[model samples]
Target: IPKTPLWKRCVQYTDILGKRLLKKIRLQYLQDNLEQRRTARSSNLLSLCRPTISLDPIL
Candidate 1:
């Protein structure tokens, strides 16, 4: 059996941490985008169901 060098261990640890961080960030971004799309879709449906009236003196 052989022991790994200290620098190699550190590099491996950093790589793992960076990957986990990136995964978390990507997941969060996707969730936020999905939420935004859902809200936009709901608002569009609501607007379509309601009639818009313009209040103008000339009209």
Candidate 2:
């Protein structure tokens, strides 16, 4: 079998690393959004008692 050249191997390694980094970033973003949603839900549950304002302030 022919061996991969050093430069080609390096390029492939960098590409794989770039893909992994991007996936990690995407996962982190998703996790942050999920946390934000959970927090908003908790606040909504709390506000259900008073019923003074809209549950969703943004609306």
Model 1 residue pairs with clashes: none
lDDT of 1 by residue, 4-59 (tens): 33333344456565766656655766787778887884456545656786655885
List, residue by residue over 1-59, the lDDT tens digit for candidate 2: 22543333344456465766656655766787778887884555545677576556685
Error of 1 at 32 (Å): 0.3
Residue-pair clashes, model 2 = 0
How does each model score on lDDT? 0.58, 0.58
Q: 47 in model 2: Cα distance from truth in Å? A: 17
- For model 1, the superposed segments whose C-alpha errors exceed 4 Å read 1-17, 41-59
Candidate 1's C-alpha lDDT?
0.58
lDDT of 1 at 24: 65
On the 0 to 100 scale, the lDDT of residue 10 in model 2 is 44
